[model samples]
Every structure is written in structure tokens, then in C-alpha cells.
Target: MSNPADPFVEELRAITGAAHVLTDDASTARYVGDWRRNYPGAARAVVRPASTEEVSRVVALCATWGVPVVPQGGNTGLVGGSTPDASSREVVLSLDRMTRVRRVDPLDNSMTLEAGCTVLAAQEAAAAAGRLFPLSLASEGSATVGGVVSTNAGGEQVLRYGNTRDLTLGIEVVLADGRVLDASGALRKDNTGYDLKQLFIGGEGTLGIVTAATFKLHARPDKVVTGWVAVRDPQAAVELLARLGDAVGERVTAFELIGREALAQVLAHGTPGMRDPLAGEHAWAVLFDVSETSALLDPTPAVEDALAGAMEQGLVLDAVLAASGQQAHALWALREHVPEAQRLDGPSIKHDISVAVSRIPEFIAEAGAALEGLLPGIRVVCFGHVGDGNLHYNQSRPPGMSDAAFRAREEAVHDVVHAITARMQGSISAEHGIGRLKQEAFLQYKQPVALELMARIKHALDPENTFNPGRVLPLPVATPRPSSL
Candidate 1:
């Protein structure tokens, strides 16, 4: 392993400061792995750049040495893309030190922020300007704006505001050759040339390192109405979404579907004060919210009426409308902690997938049946943004099942779920980028022409693969050389 005294380390220290270049094993350990701790990588050092210029210099230095640069943000990525590989042949480039909100134009409803800014910080900046940065996620507290933009994060508000891609107006990235692309001005419409900024948006730091971004903001909603509605099944949840959209139109901000198993996990393992909002044990539930521009206009009545109509049509089994802001917050807490509760439960396989909004029910039903037949008694903890057709269809070990045994079948479990997803014209990865986790599935499901185009773009931008190698793109299979011995 390279030490602090290595010339390479000295070169990196020259680019950034000595304090910014982490070389000690204890200090660099956290940067070598992912948040989930599922993917463990080894890096000689973790370089933290304080600005775009420093990031450019760091990338340029790495390129000069042919060292792969894995650009990481808040390190909250689930797909293991942010972490380096086990080879210890790479340098982890962290942008955590470059969290500068360069500008915020409330009049333009836009904010230009460095990649290191936490999602929450960006949201607060928008709020301070009397605007809204709607791209939200459970990891917003830790997930950085650059990471979200790279993954093209889609949260509850995606039903209304769309993904990070839609919210991003421009970006400033450091190409593999250490060239700076300063396209960080918010432009509502620019048709003169190719949309170059977008290439690095969801590029997952493969083509280049995203140093900063300019995001489009929105007017802050004056009022929000939240509801917890019990539905018969996924189909009912889909129908209810349609009904709610018809009544409230674009006022529908979020529509999340929670399975009974998912809810039970939360109620069982969640913190105190978290309780079931609705009465009776239903198979499925939906957590939805409607927002209005004027505080005087109460969206509660409209939501209640929609639920009532849905009940009459058998779309809604029962419902609880949040009467106060506290109640609404409590309801959202339940939905957000589903994954945490599952983690407390045990080891399991997780799949972040998406199909058409209309085909979600069918996909869920088919995928569930397929998985059960493959591994009977497997507890399915399925839930997600139903309005956007994305579902975190995760699985847990059955009661008293050996953890070792359950984990041994992860590949088989994923195969069944992914096969069904492919058959239904669904994506193996929805909001989450095809990081190391789903690279194989991505290759399997993505069209040949599409894959070719992606490879072409990667080669065109980073021909030497100086940036995140063996990530979104599948690693080439190794063929044994003719027996030389």
C-alpha cells in the first residue's frame, strides 16, 4: 500500500492541502466503503478538494498517473457506486469540502450550489429565498446535491416536480482530462448546442466529476394536506392515485404506497410514538399529500372527498386524514423509516425497480408470485412512490430462517425479481443509478443499441476510464491466456 511519503501522495497533497489528503488507515477507512457497508473497497488515500478548481487539479493529477478516480459525495449511495473497488488501485475523490452555495436567485427560482452541499442545505437555501427545492430523499440530511444529481434521485415529490434531472438546469464538471466545463448558469431554454450538462447529471461520475450544479426551484406551497389511506391492494392504490389526480390535478405532491408487511415492520421495529394511522389490518396502504399555492385554500377537503369517492368505488378501504402539521409529520415518518425498520429486522435482498405507473400492480403481483415460488415463505417488504411506478421491492428472511442460508440465495432471488421486471418492461433500477449493484442487470435488460451508445459516450469522454471504472458499465469478462507455463 502507498504511504503518506509516496510521491503520488505528495503530488495529491500539493493539489489539495496536506490536511485534505487523508492517508492514515483509520482516517481513510470510512471513505473506502459505502453507507450500507455491503461493498468494501481499499484506496491508498481519500483526496478532499475544497473547490472546483481543486477538483480539476486532483482529477488531472490522477489522470497523469492513470489512477482511477472514484468521485464520491455524501457516501449515502445504496448501489456501491460511490465507494472504490477492492483492488486498492484507485483514489477516492470526496467532494464533501466543496459545499458552497454560489448563488440563489429567488426571482429566477433557481439555485447554483457546489456538489458538496447537502440536499437539506440546498432545501434550506431555497426556503430562505422563499422558493422550493423539491428533490427530497430519506438521506437528504447526509446525501449531497451532487450525489443526488448523479443518481438522478426521485423522492416523494417526483410525482409533481420530477427527478433531479428535471430540476437541474445546469452543471459544472471536471472532465477526465482535467478540463473544466463551466456550464453552471441556470438557463430555462438553450437550444444552440447539445445538452452537454445532462451527460454528467446521471452519469454517476463515470464520464467526469461533477463539481457543482445549478438547479431549478419552484414556488413554495403555502398549504399541504396529508392523508393515510388504507387500500385493498396495489391496484387500489393506483386507482386512488388516478382519482386523486383528477380531483386535485397538479396539487398532488406525493402518493406513496405501503404494503402491509412494510407497515408491520415499521410498527414492530420503529421508534416509539410511531403507530398505525388507520384502523383494521389491511393488506395495503397509501400515504399521499396535496399541496396548494395559497394558504387560504385548504386541500384537506379535496383530499377527503377524493378518499370518500375512492371508498365508494372500493379503491380505498379506510382512511385517516392528518388534522394538524404534527400528525402529517408523524405519517411521513412512518413511510421514511420503512427501510430502517427492515434493517433492524435482518439481512435481505433489496431491489429498486420501476415499471409504468399503470403496470405497477401487475408487476408487483407477478414479481411477488415469482419470488415466492422461487423462495417460499420469503417475507416481501414492498413499498415506494407508486405514483412514479418505482417500488423498493425488498425481501426479508422468514421467521427463524438461518441468515447465512438466506444470504446465500441473494443471486437467485435477484434473478427471479429482475427476470419478472424485464418481462413486464420494467427497469431493474428506477431512481437509483445502475451502480455496481445493478450493473449486470442493467447490461442484461438495456437494449444493445442503448448499451453501445452509452459505451460510445463513455469512451468519447473518458477513453482511458480514468473515472469510476467497473461501475455503471459491466466489467469485461476475463479470458485465460493460452497456458504459457
Candidate 2:
């Protein structure tokens, strides 16, 4: 006579306060959709839990009721990993209220933080403690530490600091059966059996809900230098990157590349007060950042020396080393504001892909040419972490095209670009995980053996698939028979 889903909601409400359990459509709107506004969905209810115990209780209850649970943080994930399904049968577990800097040991160079803390907030906390938290991103202002850890996000600084995985020393997770896995041990070297924390680092909430993490921090650099260099081509940019790496070595923190069209779009529609670094138009641009110890050398002179050498060798056509902090911020703004500028231009198809660092130039040239051939008049805006070989290869409609029309062709264009990526032994989803957007595509690229292994892990962990169903791994498809001679 009564709905089966009702009791589950009631139980969840009882566990994590009635005020924290949201069932109404209005309150769940933010948790029901993806960042790109691609996969809007509905959930039975949304649960905001402030502690690991509450999260464990909700997950256990949902597991018992055969109801799926989606763990969310900040809701800034580009993929649909955090969004609930449209079935309205799942419960969304939000970690926004658990924000706190639990501990900061400057002597140990580590900080313990709750899952709800924003990336920027963690950085600030570390800075206040006279340490550095270097997991920087464009969405740092809104992206939470838990979500960053869940996705294992890599940003501009990954060249030197590495991704979220490298920064994380340990994690605390709430398992499906109301069990808590206390994997957080702040030691720098732990060779304990099977590193369990890594299992949930990039699990996309399929394994367990990440409640807290202990991140390794670094000493704040005494000197910082940022440079913007113009290159004649992608090859030249790659060469300049190599030269800079040789010159600065490990101090080279960030190395990013921007195509001509991407920069043009940014200048045309981006936020005001950011000046273009180059005097004349160039085909591509590279932003390289350097940080060093005062005991050894000053980073400004090192960066300047690298640029001068690059220019002499013809790897860099033109360059500008930031004269002041204001200029440095302005130069970085051009790179940071690219995504917003792309959105303002029109509907754009995006691919966060990675290849071998040595093959980036070739990948860009070949992939761009292939996509352009498939979709005529499409403007290729290829840019991102060249040092890490991750490119945000996006395609925008040519001037005067309707947004609706361009958007309509998104799938076909994505296929073309992704196909080339596959052929080149590159990834379809790089920084962004395979949420709903690329779940099916992941099947096309991933080996059959690997898929089976992933499924086994998922089943072993959350036997009922009660954590974020219909995500990461695609629904199985029937394999066709091979034609025999």
C-alpha cells in the first residue's frame, strides 16, 4: 500500500537529522545535475551529513534497503559522477557540512582536513600554517578536497606537485556496510601491505565515501617567477618546455600550452583587466612557472635565463617575464579564464585527454586536423598542462553559428576526436573521470579483461551497487560473434 522508498528516506532522516534530509525538488536541484549541465537527474532525497559516522549510517541503511547512494562534495565535478540518477530511487549524500581543518603539523609537513573543505580553503589553511598545499585548479574556489581526492584531480601545478594522489598521504572512508576504514596514517613512508587508501582515491564514489584526508604539504617557496612565452608552433612549444625543464629542473612547477583560437576567445569575451602577453599574434602560447629555495638561487633570474636561452635557440618567438605580482596574476588570469571564455562563445565540445608528453604536438596536430575535416568550420581550441600531457582539446562552432545547431552535433564531433585519440593510444577521459558522459565510450576503449577486473572490484566492495549506480563503468553490452572463415 505504501511506497518502499519511503521507509528508506525516513530511516536516513532519522539517522542524519530531519533538517539535513532534503526530499523536496527545490532543495535537491543542486545535487541532481552535472557541472556542464549535461546529465540532469532526480534523486529520492538528498542527505547532508556532517561526520564520518553519519555517512557510514546512511550508506549502510541504503545498502540494506537496496537503494543506491551518491556521495557528493561541492558538486563541481565536470563529469556526472556526483549527480544522482533520473530514477528518483537513490539518495544523494552531500559532505558540504563536514568542512573543517582538523589538524596541521608544520613540522611533519602534513594537514588533516575534512572532506567538505574546499581546495582553496585547504590551501589557505596550509599557507596560514606556513606550508604549501599545491593541488591547485581552476575550480579551487568551489571544488572540495573530498571530490578532488575522489576524482584524483590534476591541475596546472601537477608538473611539479603531482595530482591529488601525490599530495594525499592518507584517507578515511565509510564503507557500504557501515564500516569505517581508517586508512589515514600521516607517515611519509608506509609500505604496509596493500596501500588501501589508493583504492578509493579515484574510485568515483563507487567503492566508498571519502570522509577525510591527510595531505602532505611543502615548504612555501621563497621566490616565485611566472613567465608567458609565445611560440611559433606546438613543436616549438614542446621544445621550449624541454629547454625550461633542463634549465629550472624540479623548480619548474607549471607548464601550460594555449592554442591561438583559445587565447583569442579569452581576449574577446574574458573578464576585463587581463592583458595579452604577446605583442603580435602567435599560433600558440606557453605559461611556465618556477619556484626555488632562497638558499640555492633566486627564481626570477633562473626563469629569465631559461627564456633568454629559449629565444636564442628559436624555440620561443617572444616572451614576457612578469615584472610585478600584479602582472603575474594578470598573466595567469588569461590561462585561468579560458573555460569561462569558451562557455561565453557558444556550445563547445570538450575532451580532457592525455598522451605521452613527447607525442603531444603530434596528437594536437593530427587530432585537430581530423576533427576539422569531420566537422568543417569548427575552431579547435587545444590547451592545458603540456608538462603532464593533458590537453583540454575543445571544438567551438565557427563564427555566426547557432548554439543549438552546434550542440546538436556534439556526439558526432566527440566520436571523431575520441576515435583519433584511441588510435594514438591516448585516453578519452584524462582528468575528468568516466561519469555518464564517457561511461559507454570507456567500454569502447578499455580492454575486456580490465573491465571485468573493475566490475569484480565494484561487486566485492559494494555488492548491491548501492553507491552511485550507472556511473564510471557502463552497463554491459552483448559482444558480437566473430565471423569465421
* Number of the top-ranking candidate, with TM-score as the measure: 1
Candidate 2: residue 26 Cα off by (Å): 1.8
lDDT value for model 2: 0.87
List where candidate 1 sits over 4 angstroms from the true fold.
1-4, 476-485
TM-score of 2: 0.95
List clashing residue pairs in candidate 1.
none
The digit string of per-residue lDDT tens for model 1 on 1-485 reads 84347889899999898999997789998899887789998997899989888988888888899899999999999998999888888899999999889999988889999999999999999999999999889989999988988888899899999999999999998999999998998889999889998898889989888888999999899898898988988999998899899888999999999999999999999999889997788899999889998867877777888888889988888988888899999999999999899999889799999889999999888888888898889999999999999999999997778999999999999999998888888889988888898888898889977777787788889888888998998654222233322
Q: After superposition, how far is residue 128 of candidate 1 from its true place, in Å?
A: 0.6
